[model samples]
Target: MPRPPTMEDVARAAGVSRSTVSRVFQNGGERVSADATVRIHEAAKRLGYVHNLVASGLALRRGRQLGLLIRDATNPAYGHLHAEMNRAVQGVDRQLISVTASRHDYGTAEVEGLNRLIGQRVAGVFVGTGVTAAEDLVETVTATPMMIVGRPNDHPQIESVSYDERTHGRLMADAIAAAGHRRIAVLTAPLLYSRVFDLRMRSLAERCGELGLTTIPVDLLPVEHGVARALDVAREEALSCIVCPVDFVALDLLRAAVARGVRIPEDVSTVGFDGLGDGLDLLGLATVRLPVAEVAREAVTRMEALLVATQEDAEGPPPPGGDQGGVDATARARHLVIPGRFLPGRTLSSAPEHLRT
Candidate 1:
């Protein structure tokens, strides 16, 4: 009928500080003396004490609990990222709490979700949405150990681990050019809506220009989900290929083409990014698959390092959650770009002879 034995009981029995007991259990007695660790374990066994990692994490605030802010969980890419991040977090014996923001609300939903995570006093936060601007996220985090994930970040004070979208764009462009498509339409949202898509489109356009291919930009409005306007532009311009920034857009275009009874590859070729969607192989949609698992692992690794630095800061002169300036040069903000491989699907083929020129 008695309450379960707690860490305090074990600490008192072992004649050690509460923080020392915490370090012994939380970090496998990394810095605790051997005698203290043995005594703590002996006391825990005698008292039938078990460490509650969840309660410990919450109490520490800056412990092994991290936050993630993702957008559009329904989207295959984000879904894959969320799953991989969870796996990564669990692998390191840490806990992750996530918040989802509206994909269409631009920065408002994302900002609010980010603040919610900050209010939890998590050790650090990972921002995985592309809708919010890097500058806005940086300003919002202030001194929090925040890092950008699955989205491009170039701010000197913000760290990031993102897909190599530029490489993805160039790969798609090269595939389209090799198919002999002289003119292609790029379906993408404006920079304000999604910075990743904007960068991919810009890189695609630049590469297309280098390869002497004519590029036509088809602005995708959020109000319209279908790519009917893009199809019309392709038909009117006699474009031989249409490249989509994401697989979802490509799927929409394919559905639109099917409704219009337009033949794929024969009438025109199409390609998209993010090969994470289901049935991609069955559909044979040419695209690039972002390294979601790798990005997640790397982001978690960077976060762990940041948490360590933050802990050290708390023990030292500077306050915990201090600004970037307090951290050493090597521990300062850095960007890591991971590249993805190309999937040569059936959607991309030789341009129709009539539209080759």
Candidate 2:
């Protein structure tokens, strides 16, 4: 392959010096004339020049980059986190870099992704939803500051900004009890897959038990046979309500139930966590709303603090490889757990007389 185009090529093509090209790409094109900025961009595009933040940052020995490791950015649940965090990063005049975990090779892919960001020399990282699987990668990630967003974790090595899952679960359970849903089907993934799911399930099951509700467990399978399994449990157990741990699964079960001619809240009520999907208002689906914006803002604020601390400690020995002293002596770890909001939609209602037994 021909040698890739360089800043000098862009400068030459754009009728500007190499220093001008560096100023344009490296420093947000400030001080450079608008016409020159446009010309440089057009030239770079024509020359197939790809700006490498990692290389530039390493050369400068300084970069304001915050890494984001999201499980699936396309998922509607994380839309707010992505948008709000982007705004936060811009507010600080910093750059946001993202990596997605491979669904097929989660363990190895997550490790590779984390190392990729570290290699780029980011100031810190704001771990997005489902990245908690990197709990095992703690040792490898500790050199840079980290804050867990979109989910709760007890890892002492990293700060966490998340909503209280237990509280949301209890709120859902209370709503079910108030609505007279005695026999309910709880649809969820296995406990090992998610800490948030595990916490929500544990709280919901306990609270439902206390409320004298009969919970029919509907565990999801790998191939998503859980959707069909949900329909079976809803009918076989004569469940008056379907309480799903997350909205997507609940939506799936609801669609399947509707196809089977089940009247929602008339024949069976439904509730799900996470206010991610749409049509919930139209369907009157009761659910728990995650505090997305709060988590994003906090994640950014915490990262800034860590960055400052990292700079002050630059002369000290390198950060321990493990999660040890994740929070520097100058900054304390922030374990923020904002409460979840419960929307009392029409999906929750009195149990049918037939299922009361």
Identify the candidate with maximal lDDT: 1
lDDT of 1: 0.81
Residues 1-357, model 1: lDDT tens digits: 998777799889999988888776555455667567657765765676655433233223455778999999999989999999999999999899999998777789897787677555566899999988776676565334788999988888788999999998899888888988999988877788889999999999999999999998887774244378778888999999988889888888898889999888778888989999999999999999999999999999998887775555445554346332334423488999999999999999999888889
- Give all candidates' CA lDDT scores: 0.81, 0.72
Model 2 TM-score relative to the real fold: 0.76
After superposition, the stretches of candidate 1 with alpha carbons farther than 4 Å from their true spots are 1-61, 222-226, 317-331
Off by over 4 Å in 2: 1-61, 103-105, 131-134, 222-224, 315-331
Q: Which ten residues in a row have the lowest lDDT in candidate 2?
A: 322-331
lDDT of 2 by residue, 12-51 (tens): 9989999887875555444677567656665765676755
- The C-alpha RMSD in Å for every predicted model, in order, reads 12.0, 10.1
